[model samples]
Target: MNILLYTWLGSYTDDDIERHIRGMGINCRRIEDTQVCNGDRYHNDEFCRSFEKILEDADYDCVFTTNFLPLIARVCYKKDIPYIAWSYDSPPNLASLEEMDHPTNHIFFFSKDDVEDYRSQGLDTVWHMPLAVDTDKWDAIKTAGRDIDVSLVGRLYSSTLPVLMSRMSAEQQQFFKTLTDLQLKTYDRNILKEFITDGIAQEICRTYEADEDATLRPTRKQLLYSASTYVSHLDRLLLLRVLSKKFDTHLYSTDTEADYKSMLPNVKFHGPVSYEKGMPEVFKSSKVNLCPIFRENVSGIPLRILDVCGCGSFVLSSFCPEVAEYFREGKEAVMYRSAEEAFEKVEYYLKHGDERESIARGGYERVKADFSYDDRIRRMLTQAGVLKK
Candidate 1:
């Protein structure tokens, strides 16, 4: 099979998707087709001409890409080529779909609910094809001392946390004993305060330290409690703080290693790592992959979940109903109700490698079978009518 993957090459990592397709003995070429800056009036004259030449000469069987790019969709339409439109976000309403003039055959989405949602909105051709991970890249990593118990990957979304915390008023907290009861382990609020302090200190050190008289920026915790509700970095900070009290925690981002270490001397902080090169080591070294999100619904399962699972490492993630669609709790991956529960699960799995390995293997098998990149691309091609059944 010959395929052309129309995508943003440098955006995140699509190597897995490409590898998976090639692994199935399908020849694939990635062509960058569109740019977002074009906005509503899509125009990429150079790219369109180049893409047209590729499509005209290659005799490829399938063209898979995001439908959101209208210019590319227009090119595909002109060539009478069947194209698969991939959508990762929530499906648009009927009105929105009607506005999109391209007539794509296959619409690939992340969850079945999204498929149903699009169908309800009258999209007859939508298909459920979840995001995938590169099993080859995200494998077990090894570390020296088991220095940290919990660690998180991904950019911090700090604004959402305070809104959740402030709204949990005394009355609300008292009324919903469910959240409290779910706290299987107790967490020290002081640890959270420490996280807030460290975040502020780091910010000051990085940008404001040159001015000796500069006032300290309000800590994330203080901002959450204040009248102005949202601080985008608060969610990760809050989750980190709560987790820190329960176990030795680390924050490993692409940057901020030196600053974070200076702020929180005890907590392990490693700076930015090259995704392709550094991820494998992190997965093997860390005991538990902490996947936490403050938002619901729109908080779609991240690509890292599959990566961590593929690596044969245990994951302790925030509860999301959509997760049940891919992994079975207690069988494939662990889900936690609160920080304390998250801590306990991490500790439990760390000691019981056999059980942890069992769940890890289950997760890896599930991802390899259902969420492999090759499987997804093929499904899209088949549904798009680009490849005959």
Candidate 2:
């Protein structure tokens, strides 16, 4: 079967996703809608037009894209080719009026809650299918170790950081105190309050600001009823920084380069490396991979966990709902509830290489069995009726 993937294919995920589908013997073509200048996608008119040209030229039985490029899916829909989109996280665009602007007949969603939301909006054309990693590219490799304790490799969401900062006022403090005290019954609220009351939230906002030079220090927040992804974000950052005092730590993201260098001087900051060339080696070298996400509405596991596990390294991530659903703690991977927990877990794994290696092998096996890219695409295609079941 011929498949056209309408994606911004410069990043690690998009490239690996296409590579996995093609390896399954499907005639897959990539229509990248963005230009990577200095390791970032420049989404201008020229980039969109270039992507459209590629889509127009490619002959394919179906098209699979994320909601980021609904226009390509619209083109496929108009051409009468089956278009199936895999929305990795929440369907922000698909849930918006823009979704109706160029509505698709077939859209696959990762979050079940999102599926219900779409259904309520009278869009019955939705299916639940989570995103998977390309095990081939992300799998563990046996390389001479790079000295790093913990690392995180995702974008810095500036949008949410201000919301976290906004709650620092005396007026907002009362509201936060009440809400947190109420939440203390179920979760860790004291730690949550320190992040809010101690001006840590504002510091988080200041930390993400890029220097005038944009390279001197890499810096890299939340919501309330809004969405406090900062607690989760800072949790990872603080955990890594604390670890750096004892062991070498590194970060591999562009958004956080300035933050890492300024706030985490001892921490090695390797700004976004090419997945094709650098990520595999980086993942292979690191002793343990950290997936630190403290977002309020996070769904599906972070891609980094899969990337590290697939690369054959032990993964240490937060013990969230999705992580628990996919992996058995201490068996497939290690999990922690707080920075204290993360420190304990990392220290334990680092000391016992055999235990870490055992967990890593189990993680790789689990991903190969259930979370590989080929398996996800095949299942998605079959569900969309683009291929025989």
- Output the number of the TM-score-best candidate: 2
Query: How does residue 234 of candidate 2 score in lDDT?
Result: 52
Candidate models: Cα lDDT each = 0.60, 0.62
* Ten contiguous residues minimizing lDDT sum, candidate 2: 213-222
- Residue-level lDDT tens digits of model 2 in 57-170: 767777776644455544555566677777655424332434332334577766565676568877767777766766665533456774655666655433343444343445
Considering summed lDDT, which 10 consecutive residues are worst modelled in model 1? 184-193
What would the TM-score be for candidate 2 when compared with the true structure?
A: 0.73
Please give, for residues 84-171, the per-residue lDDT of candidate 1 as tens digits.
7666543321224532445655666665655765678676767776777767666434455334567787665324333333334454
Candidate number with greatest lDDT: 2
Report how far residue 11 has shifted in candidate 2, in Å. Answer: 4.3
Off by over 4 Å in 1: 33-50, 87-101, 139-147, 158-232, 254-266, 294-300, 351-353
